[model samples]
Target: MSQFDRQSFSLTGKVALITGGASGLGQNYAVALSLYGADVFVVSRTQKGWAETRQRVEENGQRIGFLEQDITAPDCAAAIVQHVIDHFGHLDILVNNAGMQLRNDVLDYQDADWRRVIDLNLNALYYLSHEAAMVMAAQGHGKIINIGSMQSYRAGKNIFPYTASKHAVWGLTKAYADALAPDNIQVNGIAPGYISTDMTRSLQEDPVRGPEIKAHIPSGDWGVPEQLMGPVVFLASQAADYVTGVMLPVDGGYLLR
Candidate 1:
């Protein structure tokens, strides 16, 4: 390994597109990348949290932009990438962080529900990645980060489609990495553990399920959104230039149990 330069972690002059930036981990991701010196473009279903996210990014003295639209719409990826390029003039990082989960037993899960989850979580990501990779290829280099989950490895009680989609995310990461490597674009994933987010708050509050889940984590606790900051900024920077096609778990050793 070559000597590590602290500057390798800087994202100065780069532009990043982060989906689902209206709230949760995506919001933090937008801010974190900007703090490292990257201009950011955020996309979400609504403008609910864009003002706050934009405020945070600008506070770091970085430029920020947002697009309010449902990512599940047809050709949305192409439109989003075009908007970013037209506004920013270039793109360097694509963070496929827009995801949704539906919790229900496999037997009770409806076809519509399954399709909805798959469309937003898996299909939309692939579409955006394909478009982003094209732009990145033209730029001669880029980084793509997919947000996976603990369910990417093991099955969850409910959320069958979510589990399936996340597992497929790992496959997508590898496939894209291989095909885009020659274009100088690196594709990877971050599999976060049971993070404390609005989606998981209910499960964490359940008396029985909550304790059982916590006991399984070797870290003896759940992770917060901020914990993902380092991993994302690392993958987005030069430090991970040689790394690709890997689904890195940010789980608190929950997979061990």
Candidate 2:
């Protein structure tokens, strides 16, 4: 490959931080970045499943660390960022992948439920990004990858808070990208579509809505968590240095139909 090509893709010696790294999409992202040579720092609410993720990352010969904490807490963002700096000394990438969703009709949505979803999905993400951005600005370069969802652009039933949070996330991504560009910090988002993860198991298995959802996807099937690996890895690497504020959908063309 050419010099530019190599520079764009390689993440050797870089340090990355991923929220929600214990399981699901977060775990996959941690491993994928490790495969590209980034040392990974993972934050999750529980230590469960972290051992497997750590093993997968170390198998690629990259350093990995994990911290168990509730990201929804007000002080969690600062703590997580400090922990990364303490352990790795520097950070090159931060993936805001920790999120929560509540399925309830708008009329039935309780204030507490709405707060719970927004607290993590949007609030925590913003706090974490803010802290990471400060460090990245000081370092003169960094990547911030937020985990948006298809709900970011379109509407879905019984997911009011989640939709609101995701839509806000895209806005935050753009706002941060614009604000941080001068500091060489890039902020972007990934909107995954109909991925086969535990979070979507209930919807995907719904006899009434499942087939309708599959038919809407041009690929005629649901995507697996692994399908997100490439898009995320690219966004987190030097390949996306010039790409910011955009929400790239890894959605099997779901938006087309």
Candidate 2 segments exceeding 4 Å error: 1-3
Candidate 2, RMSD to the unseen true structure: 1.5
User: Global lDDT for candidate 1?
Assistant: 0.93
Please give the RMSD to the true structure for each candidate, in Å.
1.3, 1.5
Q: Candidate 2, overall lDDT?
A: 0.91
Worst 10 residues of 2 by lDDT: 1-10
* Backbone clashes in model 2: 0
Q: Which candidate leads in lDDT?
A: 1
Candidate 1 wrongly placed segments (more than 4 Å): 1-3
Backbone clash numbers for all candidates listed: 0, 0
Clashing pairs in 2: none
Candidate 2 residues 31-55, lDDT tens each? 8999988999999988988889989
Tens-place lDDT digits, model 1, residues 1-257: 26588899999999999999758999999999999999999999988987899899999999988898899999888999999998899999999999988888768889999999999999999999999999999879999999999988987768899999999999999999999999989999999999998888998999999999999999999999999999999999999999999999998888888
